[model samples]
Target: MNKVKLKIGEFSQMMQVTVKTLRHYEQMGILKPCEVDQWTGYRYYKLEQMQRLGAIRRLKDIGFSLDEIRELFEEGSHEPNEAQLEEKIKACEEELKVLLKRRENLHQMIDSQRKFKSMEKFSIQSLPEIMVASHREVIKNYQAIGDMCCNVIGPEMQRLGCKCSATGYCFTIEHNKEYKPEDVDIEYCEQVEEMLKDSEIIQFKKMPAVKTALCLKHIGPYDRFYQSYTEMFKYIEEQGYKIVGDLRCVYVDGIWNQDDPEKWLSIIQVPVEK
Candidate 1:
């Protein structure tokens, strides 16, 4: 008998896939032969299998999981409908969003580790209750607030005779939501012995005493402080402590050079409960 159909081996060779792989796809219901010889139990592929084989290859190239591809094909006709194409597009978009978020987090971690290696470790100690002269505003721009801290806030502390305490600086967000960088309330403060008698920009506020925290001493560049925060949180978790209060970042030294992140000294403290 002159054969009109290709056997499994012939199809696999033409498609550049192994016979085992083709059999597995069959088991997965992604690809099934048009007919099987009853006596020999040999699978036969018609010309149509070539189209299915090409589709499977293309879908796999786009990061589709085998299970997902199988589902797609199970519901799909020989020619996919608009709805099916839309489903594939949506799935790929969702996967891209997840991958992008993971990439951002990893990049932040790498930058943080580099900064951590340059820091000197210090012991955690209790901070005394202190009075702070502060300025409160609904900060719409965090970058501007950061600038205000380095320029307006730091000098104000120096003038008030309230040198940077070892406890670090505190920024309390009164109201936060899906806020732009400029729309958050940022309060910048420093401990002072006495309130300024005549000051327009500075006002007095009491900082509530925190009992415990997993504190890490980080000196040099605020850019690396995120790494310090990440480390402190991990340490707190490893020690079986839970964060009980808002995190505090105390600026110890403020150099005027915005270009140099290596010269800034800051302490990051995460309040915790043992």
Candidate 2:
């Protein structure tokens, strides 16, 4: 039986792979010519090399990088390690999640343009530094936040003989670095006339001022906040602003005063810098 061999160009044409790519694969040490002419320095490939090239192309199509492919076959086997393949699958799953979130944000942006074209708008404003009564707690959900304010925090301030500021400025800051549907870590702050002694439930401190804030009006239930958030983030990216401080949600009207959720209004303040 005679062994069949083809020149580099003939092999490249039959495999439908560019000569450059074949040379790159050789440089990467994942694939190499079966024979090299000593005198002429010409490369030759056997028909069996086609199987390896086909496998390499298939793996690349499925998100495997050249380095990963090389590492997989460095042990002199075409079979990939099960653990490494599992890790790749996990990475791809996380990427899919991010892509899905981006798609959802795009749809929300479109919906906001149609539904809140005139009703909601973003404003650049300054937030003044002021004395505030602060209370930090882990709440059950966002909706239950109002209960903590009306029952726990407000009453504590009154008991401590605290005088509310004339402006009645107040806002809630989320301490969470990531979004949570429940078990929310929240810090509530309300402007006051002067600093007072710290109590178990409340502490008086001076909230820092923000020179520039990207403020957006949210008119509806709190659950629909994603719509406003999508618009705000898009605006921030368009304006080339970097978020400098924590976000504050200033409650203008809610179950505390308004009977209807539709009439409730809140302001989202995001501190930013150019």
Candidate 3:
């Protein structure tokens, strides 16, 4: 009986693998043809190589890299070491966590879109003059603003026995003369009943009333604020209105009160003159 040998193409077909994959395996030194015709540079594989190919495919399907497979083959063991298998499991678990977070974010975005489809997007309203307790800081990023308000500013307000206004007006102002990617200069203000003596952390000031402001409701995560800004600017230009003062983002619902970012509502008020 003669031993069966097959060309690279025939072996690839029989093993249900690609010729490219076979070539890669050869380069990786994990699997090589049993013989090569020197003159034509043609490759030939013996029948027994089929078993090795099967093992390689199974390992790869279970998240094993070609390098790992090569190492396993070099150790003269087709089965992975216990430590190697545990490491792969840990990596897979981490990947699963990332995928789960992404899925949750997607669901929040979908719910937000559905709720905002029919809701009013823009409005013009008169803003009343109000006394407010304000705090300013250069924060790491926009996300850190929540923590700064809850932990630092909120405590200072309570210590001073600040009286919050019935209107429940609270907003943030970006004081930076120009845009910044990080270390944002932000001022947080909450409407109060009366002015109080300035503290190291908080200041009392009366905000001027806006005669007419273009308000745009932003629905969803703070990271998506740019979307609302883009629309607001376009609308302002179309209406031939000039923005008079720095924009104020009035927070209605946020991470402090809502678990879902999609449900968070903010009204961007840009003081404008026609």
Error of 2 at 269 (Å): 0.4
Q: Alpha carbon lDDT of residue 206, candidate 1?
A: 66
Q: Write the per-residue lDDT of candidate 3 for residues 26-89, one digit (tens) a residue.
A: 9999999999999999999987689898899889988998998998999999988789889999
- Judged by lDDT relative to the true structure, which candidate is superior, 1 or 3? 3
Rank list by TM-score: 3, 2, 1
For each candidate, give its TM-score against the true structure: 0.46, 0.57, 0.88
lDDT (Cα) of model 1: 0.70
Q: Give the best candidate by lDDT.
A: 3
Ranked by TM-score, the better of candidates 2 and 3 is 3
Report the C-alpha displacement of residue 176, candidate 3, in angstroms.
2.3
Query: Which candidate achieves the best TM-score against the true structure?
Result: 3
Model 2: lowest-lDDT 10 consecutive positions? 111-120
Q: In model 2, which regions exceed 4 Å deviation?
A: 1-120
lDDT by residue for model 2 (1-274), tens: 8789889999999999889999999999888999999999899998678889988988887788999889878877676778878988998999999999889767766664555567649889998888999999999999888799889988889899999977678899999889999999999999999888999999889888899999999877788889889989999999999999999999988888976666677899999999
lDDT of each: 0.70, 0.88, 0.92
